[model samples]
Target: MGEKQGMKGYKLAIGLAIGAALLLPSAAGAAAAKPSYELEWEGGGQSSGTVIARGGVSYIAAKAIASEAGLAISWDVSKQRAQFDGWNKSFAVRVNSDRGVLDGKNTEIGGKPFVLNGELYLPVRFIVKALDGDNVKWNARTQTVTASGLGGYHARSETHNGLTFTVVTATGELYVTGESGESRKLADLGDTIYGAVKFAFYDSPGGLLHLTVTRNYGEPMIQYRVYTAVLKNGELIREAEAGYFRRFVDNATNGGGQLIVTDGRTLELVDDVTGRVAESYDLVKLGGEEDDYFVEGVGPEYLLIRPNDRGLLMLIDRKTGGKTLLYKELLDKLNQEYAETNDVPYFGDWLRFVRRDGDTLYFRNDAPIQQDNKLYAYKLPE
Candidate 1:
């Protein structure tokens, strides 16, 4: 009886030891697992990648970002650095360092890059900004980071007088949607590149619709031809003319005057009713070149000139013959917004003129580097 009782006790102890061995590995595995994040693109597709935590900051694999952004990447093991080249630019990052080289200039990154299990990890936002990626956002609740590749596909719309004009870039179709929520096709602007078309309501005796279309070819050099068209009463009155550059200048009737270039160095403002040159401005004498600059908007007192390389706007005062740099203030405001929204300062690449309403001028940064593209209204200097 004693022997049987001892045997039963030994068997019970062995069973308890086996149970503990099983539980030990499971507890260790649970502790080792870290949280992962999802990466979503503009195309509505998503992939999962490992998000590592270091010193309270989040880092993602650099290779993963390069893959999504279509960048070519290579590692220099001796230098402890990685090079990413794309979008006509190159960026290099080194491990254990916060300094990076973008396009051959030194720039500061958000955090030092690190390696984990043979994969290079970097701050995702820093890489995105350096590569001129589209807007990136992090959703902590969803554990997801959404981003768009450089030159992501998008549709655009403009509103004027309670009507919205929408351009579908993929199909090169233009549609006008009225206040009644009804939409109809207006024109077929065949095979134009993205952001190659602009529309404005011309104030004239008949209030015509003005359109500028740019056709581009020859990549890397980027040669383009500009075309202009006019529509009266939803019918195409004037077809697109080649190489004709013109804009409607604001006038007293809340209408616009046709501003055109008469000679290489002379800009003429023509009266819309009579179609005659009312006034002319000599661009060369005004310290501007006709080829390097284009008229963005003309006010009662000044004309806004934008550079061809998408630099700052130059304000030319008609009365005083004074030139004032206009976009520094606008760029300051944009940087503030960028710091708030993108957690980084704005990089000035392109300043786009949105429109003008009375004494207020609206502007936005268009390409290469941009924030959410919020229109900022700057009251014209009186």
Candidate 2:
């Protein structure tokens, strides 16, 4: 009996030791799960947008955003829906779906979708807006779609069945294959006769294409322009011209045969054929300096703008200019993490910057204080 008891005690000790060993890794893992200090922010604000949390990070839609404090994020600014990240995840998904439908990769989402560049692509507008008195609609007869939202935002476009559809955004341009078996600009009407004139989707008139003549701005100004055209029987035709605009950011569709243009501080609705500004809005006073903006047209009556700062997101009314704070205190923790990673001070009057592969924002430091070049990856609130 004594021997058996001694043996049982020894087994108990061994079991306890084993249990402790198993728990050690779990404790260490819990400690590691704590957010890293690199994700903190110093300041942030939202005009009238909502903050959305996904995968432990927070993001704000561009339209209704005012400013953010954690990290400075930049987009390609030339491509319609392209963000700072080079992956173009949205486009990739769309293209992949397209190819899957065409090539039979995997029939999952709706059906066997199509693919492009090994990435899926979808037809949804890369930039959408949510605001009061905003309307979006699609017209099948004219093959046109339109949007009208806050700040008089509007857009419209006609598409060809078997052609390539292309749209430019801040980050990069994207092309979608049309049913016409040829690649065409998604927003372009067709090829124009006059090589000098270029066209773009202006407003909801559903009229001819517009034209814009490019001017030389010398060395200081990098000319950024958008043109739309129409093509028939492989022949290009010139329809209209929208004059060169500054701070061109993104594009959106309005239901009434109009197109909306965002120039960072304002939104412009243009008439498709006449290349005229139907309406405009000054939104600079609505938000903070670091706010991010995005615009999208939903149906025929609403445009949505989502802004986020410090993990707070809000949706604003574009027409009424009313604001709403969606999420709060969600990003404060992440802001702290970002503060810990950046120790260097921001100097120099102007920082020449560029984005690489669409994900990383890089700046050439001309300041006398710093000699080493610096690169910053776009960071979101954790």
The model with the greatest lDDT is 1
lDDT of 1 by residue, 1-382 (tens): 9999999999999999999999999889877666465555544456567677677667888876676555678878685989986534578999999999988899988889998888889886676677565567767655556565543233456777666776665566667677885777766666534434555555465365555545444433244444444545544444332332232221111214563433224556655544445688875566454444456667778776644433346678888878866555666665534433542122223456678888887878653345667886778667
Please list the C-alpha lDDT of all candidates, in the order they appear.
0.60, 0.34
Count: clashes, candidate 1: 0
Report the error of model 2 at residue 217, Å.
26
Model 2: per-residue lDDT, tens digit, 65-136? Answer: 212211112334533222211112111123223221112233233322232343322221222121221243
Cα displacement (Å) at residue 133, model 1: 51
Name model 1 segments beyond 4 Å from true: 1-203, 207-213, 227-265, 287-290, 333-349, 367-370
